[model samples]
Target: MTNRAAGLLLFALISFAAPLQGQQAPAEAAQAAADQLEAATVALEAAESARDRVKALTGTVRAYEAGLGAMREGLRRVARRESQLLTQLKSREDDVAELLGILQTIETSAPPVLMLHPSGPLGAARSAMMVAEVTPGLYARAEALRRDLEEVQTLRLLQQNAAGTLEKGLSGVQEARTALSAAIADRTDLPRRFTENSVRTAILISSTETLTGFASGLAEIAGGAEKITPLSVDISAQRGELDLPVEGLLLRGFEKRDAAGIARPGLLIAARPRALVSTPTAATIRYRGPLLDLGNVVILEPQPDTLFILSGLAEVYGSAGQVIPAGTPVGLMGGSAPQAGAILSLSGEGGGTDRTETLYIEVRMDNSPVDPATWFRIGKGG
Candidate 1:
């Protein structure tokens, strides 16, 4: 199946996989990511300087974070406003309900009219006339109460719609902020690891020879994001000198995986440094933007035959038409908590929901995912 079709197929598979554990509004998420990332950046700045830099940056970062705190507080206040609105509407609803109840009771308990003894009665006609007048007044009151009830329902609907909009916006802000923070943390630590002498690195890849047949639906004439390049693998060790380009916590192997979970990983490097990504080729940047729960997204098509969807990152390096080597930094990991959802999805104390920024990586061979695990040995074992 085509890569797009494959995704659709998987999507059709009930999408019963673990659902993303977040339900935050865009605004809330954004604010949270931004604050955390800014703090990490400040720390990096502090690391780069001597004596007072840390101290100075500590305050600056604190202030920046505090500012975000203030904004969050404002949002809360708005939420509170919504609550107040709800309260107001509730009160009106209660009032209407009470009035309706009284009307209903009266309608059910209305006394039966007594027949007037017109032949021998004294003041009998006048008594019957009085009863008839009272009945009209009761009917009028009940009708008025029903109208009140209807009005209350209309008000409730309007208030509900408004609240939904605000809530969604809040969630978005939260997601965005959290992802931003994770990216900052990744970038800040990059220079340190690359310069560390004790750091280790590795390049795990498969080799191909006599390659042929690589093109796209829009082949023969393409521009903007279609400049093909061949990627060569260098897996040999160099006289005890490690060719790995990173330090600290490398993921040992590519977890081997197949369309049906039928494979295993060749290597799974645990403890990978958060500085950069390992890609095989230099490709064109096709898309770059914020992806709600995924953080910053970058699409690189290395060849007419191959493409990469790199996401779950905070900061992206190298823009469109830029050259990035195998170990080039595409972006910072969205968060380093093993799973992207730990920090991004959490709000303070996990009161509302969980969120994590995940960089969705999908490789396409002419618009189809060719099971990256087969090549990288990522999904082989697990």
Candidate 2:
């Protein structure tokens, strides 16, 4: 039999093996995987068709990036399932080899010929009895193999579809980047702001080694600048009642260590690509530009002491010192996947129903990073 056919049969036998410790029920796991795949597929379709709604090139990139993230997530889940299947198959090597031998023998002989083989009636009768004894087990194994084959086929199809979606998303991001670069080059008109010190800003950015350090330096600079806006709502009062700027899955929570073992104080939200990014509360734009490592950074001051540092954006809107209302559009997060220092949290804090665009939000008080989850109600619009 072919490797795939052998794999199916092995799955049948091993699926009946004892469940792995701490593993969820197979039905629950299967249902969850199905749900995730369906959600990712839907998000990808939406992203592919959503160019008209988001006219800005930055928004387009964000949307497509979100789609890519969803695709990656779906692929990861499929891989996990494949690994589990392989592990089960490996554990039952002897059983699988025996089954394959039986299949091979059956394929090589006709039923009538097998019944009349070797030493005639006596030997044939013994062989027939042995076959009959194992017939029930074979039937059960066959049924399981059939089910496994169908599931494997479905997963393969999903992987193919996700790869196609990712290719399209990458193309969208490329086109959007070209348009945005052109727009930036031809830029003439822009709003004025209190913290528009180009020379000092450049020096501070060059001096800082980390994003947090850069933010602290900027915060220090903003302290001396003229006040731009008065607080409209008490930021502290709205704790746990604030809505996210965009809707997507939460991949990591505040103070979580990333893949590199570096823990930053913030929440990483995986939103849909091209999804609108607004402020969770009324705030004044402190600064908006590309910082070291971060794609595009937008700093918002909802109150005198509280600064919201949002990074991983592709495009930013509003100007430094611009006072905007609550939920005002500030920028679009980058569409590109994160390279380092990002991983799903152990507690699984931010995994929402969707996985697409990733937006990082850092809350700081007096230049100290604070947990963003403590301020916003997760899994709800608020």
Which candidate number has the best TM-score?
Answer: 2
lDDT (Cα, 0-100) at 377 in candidate 2: 74
285-324 per-residue lDDT for model 2 (tens digits): 8788988887788988888778888887777876776666
Query: 274-305 in candidate 1: lDDT tens per residue?
Result: 33343444345444444334456665555545
In candidate 1, which residue ranges exceed 4 Å CA deviation? 1-286, 291-295, 335-357, 379-382
CA lDDT of every candidate:
0.38, 0.62
Q: How close to the true structure is residue 17 of candidate 1, measured as C-alpha lDDT?
A: 29
lDDT of 2: 0.62
Question: Which prediction has the highest lDDT against the true structure?
Answer: 2
- Residue pairs with colliding backbones in model 2 are 62-273, 62-274, 63-273, 63-274, 66-356, 66-357, 250-350, 271-357, 313-333
Per-prediction TM-score to the true structure, in the order listed? 0.27, 0.52
